[model samples]
Target: MIHHKTKVAVIGLGQWGRNHARIYAGMPNVHLAAVVDVNSADLRGFAHRYKAEAFTDYRKLLGQVDAVSVVVPTNLHFEVASAFLETESHVLVEKPMTATTAEAATLVELARRKNRVLLVGHVERFKPAVRRLAELARKPIFIQARRVRPYDRTRTMDVGVVMDLMIHDIDIVLSLVRGRIVEVGGLAVRVHNSQEDLAGCVAWLLASRVSADKAAEIEVTTPDRVIRLDYLKQRLAIHPFHGEVEDMAIHGDEPLLAELRHFINCVNGEEQPLVSGEDGLQALEVAHRLLQRMSTVAPPVRV
Candidate 1:
């Protein structure tokens, strides 16, 4: 058991936030203090089901918990986390840390000053295959990643695919390369709405180099040694460097619960945070670079 107990609250009861509450509520060392959501039905249902307090005002929940997870929209991340941190509560936040780099920096600094554990919710990093691959990653000369969706018209109302989906692969790539991006190029198309649904980006990073990812965006990721991920027919594809590619149809599960377990471990001071604010900021920086470049046809080269 962890040395000290921790009280936690999950703010926002959206689809993603509900998962956060589920995981935290089950952890033995943590207390799922409360869940705050504007929707009365969702708030009541989740609170009763999880045996956590229900409230519409996060501020009210703030005084009642030691740590909180912010699962609201990307735009509200900075505002909500800041409020909780200012009150001396540790925070675990969902990705795209904040809408702006400055806001992300502010939260990072605020958490540091207060000696609070500030963790970002980058769920894919916790995948078993990724954890094993990262251990074996070496200098890779090239990299390519693809993240496609059937079409969730309402999912990305505030951000594009770069932020909404590709950002996951982007963060994974950046983490492995650990390089300074020399230049970035992108191609995106909005398959369903005003925002770009399909995005492809290439980063020329001055990286230390590592082995490439075997599976990206529904593809099975392979490492130098061992057969890690299982790919079903079209669900994921596993490649053999020496043999023909193998295809399988299977669904890869989301690792949200494992991620929250890791966050609680970080808060318990048993291990360092898996996704730090700096990591989130780095991913956001790359995401913004792609979108900014995509916005202009070719901003007449600066003389």
Candidate 2:
């Protein structure tokens, strides 16, 4: 078997998964072997567009592909991704990795035991501005992140806003800090859905050069600088000894296209995932702690 032309299958061809199908099919090193979804309607265009087989049941495609991209809902993440790993296939699961820390651990251990690659699609890490910021990070002191959506009701029902949105920031922060978490304090409330729609958290680094007094703010301070990322605006600003704000705007582009290509690299032994399964698990761990500390203050049940 030629290792370079790795065949791949995509489970769950919904809004997000469809994009994965497109990129994997188009990329040079990958062969988009198949797409599996419970809904045939969703699989129709995907099969035609990607020149890949479509299946209502993923089990049929199990041994046919070398790798699988599990882009299913958070609830199904554990079941779907674990199935692929059991067959010794590499997995690239979309973020929040799994519904619980235990499930994430399961996938991670399975991948390790099978000697297969397990990557997390924390696509935010692939964003150009975020990529640039990561390149310059040096033991960040404090951090702040804000991710607001206009009530999709797509994922919030399954998990809290902390998982749907904030988890991305959590992943980035954890990857950058690479430090010990001293304390965690948070607040969350259900603005519209039964699950919390809004959440904000503060994590303090135990030993750092940034001023401890500035702990109240979301600023990621370091010994020499204070950087703030405005993901919404695709802008990043850096504070240094000489100046206060050095704003940078990411050029027009899409990052997932880049991320898809990177996955191919991992399969070919060219590179490693920017965010591995363990990295994704850490973010979820932090989120679970936050949700635990501050009970879900949902708007009354509408029976």
Candidate 3:
């Protein structure tokens, strides 16, 4: 029952944070109160474009806004997000929750103690293709997911590919399947010097920072049918036991916008977050196991 606009801020004016600021400025009941970044030059441009105050330090912008989107690098997530939650502001933190499971658990507990809405930015869960897959794959037995992209120094520099890219599929697969992960395994290679870590797993999951083209594909096996999803195209293909493959009619929306809108709704007491902090922790825990598994193998020597 929000009758007035909610004051919001976007922190870390990197590529993703700028998009959050843009989307929030356009929303009807949200006020883009502030944008924060260490890079003063970029901060001024975003602040001018959105007509919102810009701050070089995030702490100065905290008390002014009712909620904040923390799109900072993965390493800074826990520090920034916990500060906001301590102040009782709702937060929408970008995925992987934090660099470690212990930090994620602490945030989850603090959010509960403060009675705040803490949401994670697992944008894939809002995809029409994934939404449809959730409905159709009622008993998914196995899932195969591939998320590959050309080496981009701007992304995943703070973390490995499993956390940056594959974590999306990990969250989605955990959502579709019923049982806990009893087993896990994988392999990862570092094809570029910018990679923070060369770690990946092989348990039906593959993510790389070495591909020539951008690709995101997932295949799910259920009792009755097999489902395939292309994340970039937002398409879903289903194969029944007796009939030919059928393409699902997907009614898609911009995932980041939908995710942010959901955060606003939660802030307004209209609905619970589609992806909660605990859910993000679950995905992160699985990702850590994958990383731990990959750590056993010796990484290729860089020349």
Q: Which sections of candidate 1 miss by over 4 Å? A: 1-4, 154-156, 204-254, 295-303
For each candidate, give its TM-score against the true structure.
Answer: 0.82, 0.88, 0.94
Write down the lDDT of every candidate, Cα atoms only. Answer: 0.72, 0.76, 0.86
Which segments of model 3 are wrong by more than 4 Å? 154-156, 194-202, 296-303
TM-score of 1: 0.82
Give lDDT tens digits, candidate 1, residues 1-303.
567568999888888898888888888888898889887576787699989888898988655678999999899999999999888898998998999989999999999998888988888787766664465445544555544435433553677667776777778878777899888877655444566655666652111011143224422234432222321122334455667665445434457877887777887788898789889988998888888776423223467
The residue-level lDDT of candidate 1 at 55 comes to: 87
Q: Regarding lDDT, does 1 or 3 come out ahead? A: 3
The superposed Cα distance between candidate 1 and the true structure at residue 10, in angstroms, equals 0.6
Best by lDDT: 3
Q: After superposition, how far is residue 149 of candidate 1 from its true place, in Å?
A: 1.2
Cα lDDT of model 2 by residue, 39-155, tens digit: 657576769877888889988977678999998889999998998899888899998899999999999999899888899999888888787777666777656654555544353
* Better-scoring candidate (TM-score), 2 or 3: 3
Model 2 worst lDDT window (10 residues): 207-216
Q: Determine which window of 10 residues in candidate 3 has minimal summed lDDT.
A: 193-202
Which window of ten consecutive residues has the lowest lDDT sum in model 1?
A: 205-214
Pairs with steric clashes in candidate 3: 185-202, 186-201, 186-202, 187-201
